[model samples]
Target: MTAVLFFLFAAAALAGALGVVLSRNPVHSALWLVLTLLSVAVFFLLQSAQLVAAVQVIVYAGAIVVLFLFVIMLLGVDREETLSDPIKLQRPAAIVLGVLMLGEVLVLAGHEWATGAQTAHGVPIHGLMDTGTDPGNNIERVARVLFTDFLWPFQLTAALLVVAVIGAIVLARRSGERPEDPGPGIPAAERARPGSGSGERPEADAETSEGTS
Candidate 1:
């Protein structure tokens, strides 16, 4: 049953990952990424890592992805016209990197499987839950190392993320507020609609002048 569940989630993860890469729309790609993250959380649950699974769902899928969607919304860049690939070599480079990653994954998987098979009878693979008295040993140990040795780096990463989000918001708002050029001597308001300003519509001003006289 465990093996069956693992394979199911593994397939879902793979499909979701492929969808993320293939989807043209950024929003659709982000939704596909949620699917991939959820599948990974399920895998963590199957491994008895409940804390990791919770963080995977709550922190990544919930907070981070929602923040991503917020930035996407703010940018308002979903139009098909704006979807052109600026860098010509980006697609080819991504394909090459993806292929290399796949090769590495295959090699690691084969090595682990062979080692596990060889030790199947003599030794058992003990996970964090099995080795320690505390059921939350994996999470605790990770938190210890993260907060102790990697605390500064972790805080720096968080600060960088915050700065990036602020920068995106500022750029989006600045672009939105910028007025398009409407030729020489055109008032910004009059440019919004033809003949709607004092200078643009002289006939209306002249009529008012005659009425006043």
Candidate 2:
């Protein structure tokens, strides 16, 4: 059952990753990323790392992906008129790369799962719940190392993420706001129609029509 689940989620993770790369729409790519993150969280669960799985879902899928979507919406890129592949031999190249990636994954699967697998503190994290005395060992260990040893690096990464968000805002501001564009609730055609802005204008026009009649 474990093996079956592992393969299933591994396939899903691969598919999600491909979608993230192949998707032209930024929002679609972000949603694909969420699939990949969820698949990874499942892997952590299989490894008996509940806290890691929870963080993987909450921090990465929840917070980070939300931030990405927010930034993408703020950028507000216009959609392409055509979806055809513009580059020559793009499809062929993608197929070749995909086959190579599949071969690599197969090769890695043949080897022991322990090969090059370790936590940030170089501790092996294969089966924490199965081996550890306390059920909360994973959380305790992670918090200790994260706060004591890797705190500075963690804080730096967070600061960089904030900087990236601010940079996106700055870029959006440079593009300038399109105040002329109608709000989401209002139809653009309705906003542009003559005498739509003021109720008094319509009433005055009706009075003039009556007088002329």
Candidate 3:
């Protein structure tokens, strides 16, 4: 059962990672990244690292990926227009790096399998240990280690979150009070007054002729 679960989680993690790399849309990439994070948490569960799994979900899948999505949306980039150019170098470079990473992972997995099979007792040394303690104790151990040993990293993560929140707010805000509308320039009284077609003009002409005679 454990072996089956391990294989399942391993496959899921690899698939999710591939999806992240292959997805062209940034939003889709972020979604695939979430999947990858979740699959990694499953891997952690298979390894009996429950605290690590919880943090994996909370810090990565929940916080980090959501922030990524927020930034992606806030940017409002037109993916089609941006990616229209052909002969781009990034795609090939990414593919090469991905292949290299996959090869490395395969090599590591093979090495671990060979080492595990060659063991005399045929028992997994790093398999789940019977800690004979409550799950709460495990949680407490994680908290203690995080606060004592990993405090700097934890605080740095908090600071990163703060920056993200501030950046999102700034990006989402409208530029300013939105310039006031400049209405029609003509006054209402001038617009309402009637224009003289011939009455005032002809009278003024006749008075000018009589005064000249």
Cα distance off (Å), candidate 1, residue 195: 35
| Candidate 2, residue 115: lDDT | 55
Worst 10 residues of 3 by lDDT: 194-203
Give Cα distance to truth, residue 85, candidate 3, Å: 7.3
**Residue-level error in angstroms, candidate 2, position 181:** 10
Off by over 4 Å in 1: 80-97, 108-136, 151-213
Per-residue lDDT tens digits for candidate 2, residues 3-121, read 77888999999999999987888888999999999999999988887898998899999999997887677658524436777998998998999899999998785555635543433
lDDT of 1: 0.70
Better model by lDDT: candidate 2 vs candidate 3: 2
Per-model lDDT: 0.70, 0.70, 0.66
**Candidate order, TM-score descending:** 2, 1, 3
Q: Using lDDT as the measure, which candidate wins?
A: 2
Clashes of each: 0, 0, 0
Residue 199 local lDDT, model 3: 34
Q: Alpha carbon lDDT of residue 16, candidate 1?
A: 91
Q: Which stretch of 10 consecutive residues in model 2 shows the poorest summed lDDT?
A: 169-178
